[model samples]
Target: MSDEGRRTHGFRRRTPLGAARERLLEQVTPHGRTERVRLRDADERILATDAVAERPVPHYRRAAMDGYAVRAEDTFGASDRSPAQLRVGETVGPETATRVHTGSELPEGADAVVMVEETETRGESLTVFDAVAGGENVAPVGEDVEAGEALYEAGHRLRPSDLGLLKSVGNEAVEVYERPRASVVPTGEELVETDPEPGEVIETNGQTVAQYVERWGGEATYRDIVTDDEAALRAAVERDLDHDVVVTTGGSSVGERDLVPEVVDDLGEVLVHGVALKPGHPVALGVVEGTPVLMLPGYPVACIVNAVQFLRPTLREVGHLPHTDPPTIEAELTRKVVSDPGTRTFARVQVDRDGETVTATPTRASGSGVLSSVALADGWVVVPDRREGLDAGDVVAVEDWEWSG
Candidate 1:
């Protein structure tokens, strides 16, 4: 029932995923520094303050189409059989019509626009062929948005259309939260840069974790690979304590070479040593020099799962990202997958959408060390700790890999 037992037995008594997440979130405080950025450069940045419109969009009443501006009554009783002729004038009046093009300013006293196709111009007079109601085919002032309205509220993540909308409302710049800085350190004696011998493994989890950190709205600093030496690994993590958060992949298990947990404990405090999640049970949550430190498993899939389950949420919390669930779709399982009842499992599956019915098939390579399993998967389906497994034809919500978080 202790943390030590949980680590050795695949989370038989491991902390629940939700409890672990809550503990980490409780310790995270958003990087609340506000900095003004150009509207064009504000995409994907979380807003630190509300953006109020200085002026109404469009700012003027204009014609929505090419037509002749006139009073609604002036076009009354006009049809293909019975046409009404009105004198062309410089200004709009009951007895006068003024020629206007699309987006042109409407003349004074003009309340409607009759399409140019509906009128025939002869000399200084226009013969109307149809009748238009008041305010018809004309755009009123503030039709899109009114002045002094809030375009975006604090904590809102700016999207591409948000940029255009802010520009439409005359916002040239905006205040956004400063992105949190994350330091990623990869440790293992067998880790190599590029060329790997028979016993050596290519070090890529650092890059993977860094990319995930960046995608979750934090700035990532990928440190060089560290060997299994305790002093070297400890020094590398200690040097990065100045960053907002520290993440280390490998050296997290209970093996003799595993030193991250010890380093974190010696430097500060270890909050959590293991979790009840398959392929991610070896994750370590701790603090080093007042900064949050997360230790992930060395296996590629385990690294990915731990990063998503813990690191992503931590980054989002500290970076002030919007609290929104990752995009998901409901799909029926193509086949049954057995899972340990003691641990929650996140199995990668490929989803096939055929009309309304969606089917999810498990990836061929499901091992924790297989990196291709994640690459080939479209999303993941979670089996809760209380549930034995999912049955074939059972509906499950699949978290999209690209849109989740």
Candidate 2:
């Protein structure tokens, strides 16, 4: 791993961000796997088939208030001065009323429910002080959902609120597309999990990528650091081919220690080597054994940017999840953000609001290695490839990158 054996730089020509993304995505496709899962295990799962209701919610007529189920016309024109009296019973008739509570099943021959506050019960007799029309204060069959109703179509991501509706429709389990499985392997000889001395770095990229995978609706398997060696890198990749996507962090550049891209290229084909991206131009993409292999930059900020651009979309595609754009907010730039004319830049900035105006101030620690800059930033302002820089006082939209919703 000395300079004498360093790999030559591959940036003879860098691919534009759009072209690189298109190339990478062309080789990736959905796994198309589906499985049945109980409601307890189906949170955030995508439906694989149309969900139709077999049974209507609240199949029986129900009381909507606490009082009595009685004929609506029996209490017409009745009031506290001259209340309508009826005998209490299990069933309702012209002169009889059945006591009921909210959500209670309506008794036979009852057309409506009279509220408890509008009626009084005395010695097995009920007195109604208010008038009610037919079907008032009552939930009839199919009020919430009718039988044979199509609740959801395929390719729909289920939310927490959806479980109750499915349950009410008699669905104890559902068929859903499998979550994309990701193998996040961290590589670098100088990487250590803890107690890092000088020249050694604490491993965090794998964990960060893994967590992001989960947040983006995929499953992640985080692995230990794979040393900077061709054999070790190849084995690490081979071990995770079963996963939907293989993600490797660190050693992705042209340095001698950056052997991941080489290993991937030797095993398969490197779709993209260098991209016209700021702080993360060294990111590489390839496919090995039909699995997309993503080689991210070692620097924390660079890795994050590349992950958000590449891995996030790859996971969504493989898992059959829809691509979601991160939320954004408009803000005024407090300082000029310089960018190369042909390179796409994501400038991290601290956001603040003054009365009615929001401001974005570029962080001092803006280098690829400055992880704190990106961490403290509320979001990022993207300077397009055509724009040289954004001047101060210019209004820009800052993407709320952390909001998954």
Candidate 3:
């Protein structure tokens, strides 16, 4: 066979996920700009610096329940059999013991809290049965978090709970990293705008990519749906070169209308042409105008998977945010999985953990175009390329579809 025929038939084999990821990381450099932002607008933003508590949480000692506070010694040795009676005026000051409710502060000279339920009220005196302990129902100062302590380290992503923590620490404003901006371009001749006629497929990748970008803490500032024409693709990519990151879908493979690689070569350098993973083998990475541009496959599943595997991590790395792996658990396969020995395969699976056994239901369709399988799956199983296949009842690691808690 000629070199062209051999190249067309089989030349470069698929790499394993680990090796592919390493190569990608080596090719791409982190974005080198950081800006400070306010906490109010810092939701999902990364923390460029560690946030220390401005002051001790619960700055003052507060009551935990509404009850009269008194010295514990005065109520000791008091029981139902022989109740101890103390005059209200002698035991506590005026307006202190007459009536108390939950979370009421203890009056001066009182050292312990006596619950109302433990005492029987009379005309001017009260009968006490149970003994009380000092500081039993009080929330001491700095009980939850100490002053000058680090609340969150640098590179932490601010969540709702983190905002609440900031509020508790009397922090009205906090410094965080500015959100990175991204541009998305979807290219395909068969794809039409969301509102399309009968045979044309509606453009869904842009919307999906935008949503995923937002969820991953990057703002999709530019979105354009272009045809497979090389000129249109190059123009769209050039327009989006000013963004921190640019993403284009379709036209990335070795087809007649595959203009992504050509445009990248014309505008900048192509870092990678293919990855060693199923559903996203034709993924491309490039740099243009000092901004990173990722060319993802056209299929919905392939696009989504590549977005998570590549784009999400890149954004987090450049934004100085911590990236966590998807939740995972051990599960037993319900059936066998036959796969090639070249690429790492991600199989859609439905996982249910009952008692100690986790059952995984493999989906029938694993095609890159099958978006429904991803939606229907509870998680996914990673089948290494070196392994021939997974037998029924084999225990494997299952990565959860969504982050839980």
Q: After superposition, how far is residue 192 of candidate 1 from its true place, in Å?
A: 1.1
What are the per-residue Cα lDDT tens digits for candidate 2 across 1-405?
Answer: 454544445676789999999999999989889999998888889999998888998899999898899999888888889899888887899878988999989998999988989988778888888888999999989999999999999998888789888998898999999989999999999999999999999998899999999999888999989999899999999999999999999988887778888899899999999899998999999999789999999999999999999999999899989898999989999999999999999999989998999999999899999899888999999999999999999999999777664
**Would you estimate the TM-scores of all the predictions?**
0.87, 0.89, 0.79
- Candidate numbers, best lDDT first, in rank order: 2, 1, 3
Q: Per-residue lDDT for 219 in model 1? A: 89
| Higher-scoring candidate on lDDT, 1 or 3 | 1
| Residues 175-260 of candidate 3: C-alpha lDDT, one tens digit per residue | 77666778988889888876777767888878888877777777786465789887888889888877778899887777767778
Give the clash count for model 1.
0
**Which residue ranges in model 3 land beyond 4 Å of their true spot?**
1-13, 27-45, 64-66, 71-86, 89-102, 109-111, 114-122, 126-140, 146-149, 194-200, 329-331, 350-362, 402-405
What is the C-alpha local distance difference test score of candidate 3? 0.76
Which one wins on lDDT? Answer: 2
Judging by TM-score, tell me the better candidate of 1 and 3.
1
* Candidate numbers sorted by TM-score from highest down: 2, 1, 3
Quote the positional error of residue 43 for candidate 3 in Å.
5.2
